[model samples]
Target: MRARKTTMLALTAGALTAGLAAGVAAPATATTSVLVKPGKARPGQNVTLQVPECETDGFATSDAFAGSAALDGAEEVEGRAGLATIGAHTPPGTYQILAHCGDVNAVGQIVVLPGTAPSPRPTPHGAADAGFGGGAGGVNVVLLGAGGVLLAGAAVARSRRRDDVTA
Candidate 1:
């Protein structure tokens, strides 16, 4: 009976070790996450989404988005990439963005800054007016003014000293 009990204990220990080994050898499950380009955006701006775990296609939806953005998994550059535009009148605040890719789902956040977006600047037609290229070298107006004031103070002190000596 004692021998039988010892054998049973040994067998249980061996089975546990084998199970652990198999678990360690098994392939790790894929981790899925949705990435939002320019995580923070202004209203009416477009944002890019990338979800590598999506096997075929995905869609990103958010209250801030103008509409649901379709994602294509076929693109090699950005996996399951898509573009979603922020609504023009979306209120300023943090909004949750959800991406659905087949059975997988991921979540991300986008912040809408308060105030309207500035209009896009028109492309320049020709060379910019560089003003003789002098503006490129930064000038400290405060430092220049301080130096002038110091020079004036020194001149006044020197004149006072000369007057004293003459007297």
Candidate 2:
């Protein structure tokens, strides 16, 4: 039993030493690289961006709408991973992706075509001038009030009999 134990210990040590000597050991520093998957997509389509996991690592996007590259927003990196999703909104052309790891950075590309136009806009209705919340209340209320006042004045005049006036 003692010899078996010694042999197992010796084998474990030998394996670890061999790994270190062959430079197959784990790296002390991580590889700094950024990659985009399924990077190409049509307009109004979405693509995934992979970023290095960092506390402040996030993503940005650009569009032809601005005639320049633009960034959408940044998201929190979770558990050694950072990612972003971008939609193809720029005019049909090649697009660039910029991946960031805190201060570190990477870039990716995609082709966006005028694959489809936006859905049609709904038709607009003419202004309603005969309803509430319109200027209708102002005109209607003032007219009704004036008519009532005039009616009351006529009724009072008829009710009263003026005494005969001497000229």
Top-lDDT structure, candidate number: 1
| Alpha-carbon runs more than 4 Å astray in model 1 | 1-31, 74-78, 123-167
lDDT of each residue in 39-137, candidate 1, tens digit only: 888898888888877776878899999999998865465568899988999999999888887767778888988766677789877556575444545
Model 1: weakest 10-residue lDDT segment is: 127-136
Q: Please give, for residues 58-126, the per-residue lDDT of candidate 2 as tens digits.
A: 454445222222222355433224333335445677766555445445555666666753555788776
Q: What lDDT score goes with residue 106 in model 1? A: 74
By TM-score, how accurate is candidate 2? 0.34
User: Could you tell me the lDDT of residue 159 within candidate 2?
Assistant: 62
TM per candidate comes to 0.52, 0.34
For each candidate, the alpha-carbon lDDT, in order, equals 0.83, 0.53
Stretches of candidate 2 exceeding 4 Å from the true structure: 1-33, 53-55, 64-89, 117-167
The alpha-carbon lDDT assigned to residue 17 of candidate 1 equals 99
